[model samples]
Target: MSLTLYALGVAVLLSASFFYLFGYRSWRRRRVMAKPFPADWQTILDRDVWVYRHLPEPLQARLRPLIQVFLDEKRFYGCAGLTVTDTMRVTIAAEACLLILNLPLSFYDDLRAILVYPSAYRVPDIHREGEVLSESSGVHLGDSWQRGKVILSWEDVVAGAGHHQHGHNVAIHEFTHQLDQADGSADGAPMLRSSNALRTWSQVFSKAFDNLQKTLEQGHSELIDPYGATNPAEFFAVVTETFFERPRALHREHPALYRQLQQFFDLDPLSWTRAGD
Candidate 1:
């Protein structure tokens, strides 16, 4: 064959291979979503993930496939001799899936593993006491790592998941961190589509976060958790917990903040019926 013709044929073959390589991953995920959701898994979600019960019927249908794909693609490991069960997996996946129900993302594509402890676990953390910086282990209910991991206390998960009105879901809190840390450690803002969106988010979140910090410093804060005052990262996660678990209160208290979350999430959770503990 002519040398030029041979080179053209090789280029065509490489192009086809590239397309197939990427296309196959998308196809595999679709196949995972297509598998019929098991009855046992559905029951687990209904029982543990109270928020799952409140999703709009269409969204509920949309979320199940996401849960399936998450369980399929991500690895889950039990900690402290705890054995990860279907109830734990379904409950955790259900809440995390809600964060991406409307977004055109690959179901937390950067995340890979979820570590669940039976209860509160301790990890290396730092604390400043009396002007002294001390490095020590701190007991935490949950935390997210930018390097493709999330750690949770299953005990807290069950409590937070079952009480939708309390505005304290560890699953939602940690996953929001994952979203905020799209590019790196949680920086209070996720990747926005445009500079205008980023600017708007910055303005709205800054004002609201400032207000929250000031109010918390003065006295007992209600509706929005005081933990949001820790920093912008925690502010984003804490408010996300309030946004989903206590939408009415968040909207009534921080209207601008509520609207910002609504715009980014593309869902007005204000309509969902809040469950009583």
Candidate 2:
């Protein structure tokens, strides 16, 4: 009996070790296989002169390969009588690449493809228990799901690329969701560099999120879209668009939040806008 018990314990330990080793190896392999955008991608992405002109040289260099991978791998379909053009493809690729530039390019390793529609599309509803209920129903301009796909409306993408404000860019919103998912969940928080940074991020975002919710409940004029108050994730994405598009307004109205976002993105759009102005 003693020998049998000892053998059983050893077998359990061996099994646990094997599982751990296998899991770690699988994770490492996936990380290694996540490719960086290729070098010659610019030849293809340069088709869109407008987008190409706006990109900074360093960013352009980094984004070329990523954009190429996006164009090659993703399927872009026209909906609602819309047509896809080189300009449209380049523009969309530029916006998506902006999120990956200056960050770990492999952060999006799991994102397999992007799907674009012509405009806001209606999702189907489900019938439940003799009651016709709107199930999976929403007028979506964009969405990022955990299953390695992102969906967007081309109209919203164009509007976001041009206007940057009005708090309704589906690209920024959905990409933000992608960033949130990098750490394996879409809980409105991305992986931080340090514990202290994480703490500060949580505090600042929580305060701002709560404030936005309060403003929405009170029905007061707000600097940000009220839809942001719907959740922390939405709040981060909404504020991100404002941070980039309407930097002056964001700074003037919510200086603290703006500062936090500046730190998070490591880009000072306010200064950039000011210089441009």
Candidate 3:
């Protein structure tokens, strides 16, 4: 009887091991397949003239293929009487591509869908309060989920794209959240390449975040948007918009912060902004 029990236990262990290996192998295959964007996708990307014109030559080249992947696999939705237009699609794609232009294209592999609303729409029932309490109520311009969906308001998106100095771009802000979420948490820092880079990033961002918090507490108007004072994640996203949109002013006021962003993004928007057509 003892021998029979031991043999049965061994068989069960072997079966479990087989299932684990099979599941792991399947997951690995799917991950590898997700890396390469489909061919013939450039045609879809080329339809956008504004993105082609505004982005720098090097950035454009890098962005084209990444945007193609976004167009191919990502699902898009229109809600709250919103209509998804070609121009809106191009704008959102362009902004999102900017985030991954310098890094591996597979960084955004998990992203599978985009949902757009006509304007800021309310999300009812985020939490159950037994009485259906509408506790978290606001007009959100954009939101990114951990499960691969990005939500945006078309009106806010267009406005943000058109006005460079406003320090508000729903597309950039939500996609930045996606980047932060890539590491399974939406803490301030995203995945960096080297230890040195990580160290420098933490030090610079910590100091800047603390200062921004203090400035907000003091009830002072800051050069960067006060919304950045919301938290570390929002601060990173807000500063990113300023870095690209108002580079000269950011550099003049917060030189060290600008330098940190330059190292992280590996591009000088100040140069791009200065060399205007």
| TM-score leader | 1
Clashing pairs in 3: none
Candidates, ranked, TM-score? 1, 3, 2
Off by over 4 Å in 2: 1-56, 72-83, 125-136, 275-277
Task: Give residue 3's error in model 3 in angstroms.
Answer: 20
Q: Between which residue pairs do clashes occur in model 2?
A: none
> lDDT for each of the candidates?
0.88, 0.72, 0.75
Per-candidate RMSD, Å:
3.4, 6.3, 5.7
Error of 3 at 215 (Å): 1.2
lDDT of 3: 0.75
Residues 1-277, model 2: lDDT tens digits: 9999999999999988997766654555455336664434344355433334455677567666666655665667666677777656767777776776666655666677777788899976575766655567768888888887888898888777765545566787787788888889777778766889888888988998998888878878788888888888888888887876777888888898888777766666665454432
Overlapping backbone residue pairs in candidate 2 total 0
Candidate 3 residue 75 Cα shift, in angstroms, is 1.0
> Taking the tens digit of each residue's C-alpha lDDT, what string does model 1 give over 1-277?
6999999999999988987866776888899999999999998888778888888899899999999989988899999999999899998998898999987655388899999999999888888889999898889999899888999999999998887887889999999999988866578998876889999999999888888877878896567788888899999999999999888888888888898899889888878775332
lDDT of 1 at 147: 88
Cα-based lDDT at residue 95, candidate 3? 80
Better candidate number, 1 or 3, judged by TM-score: 1
Q: Is 1 or 2 the stronger prediction by lDDT?
A: 1
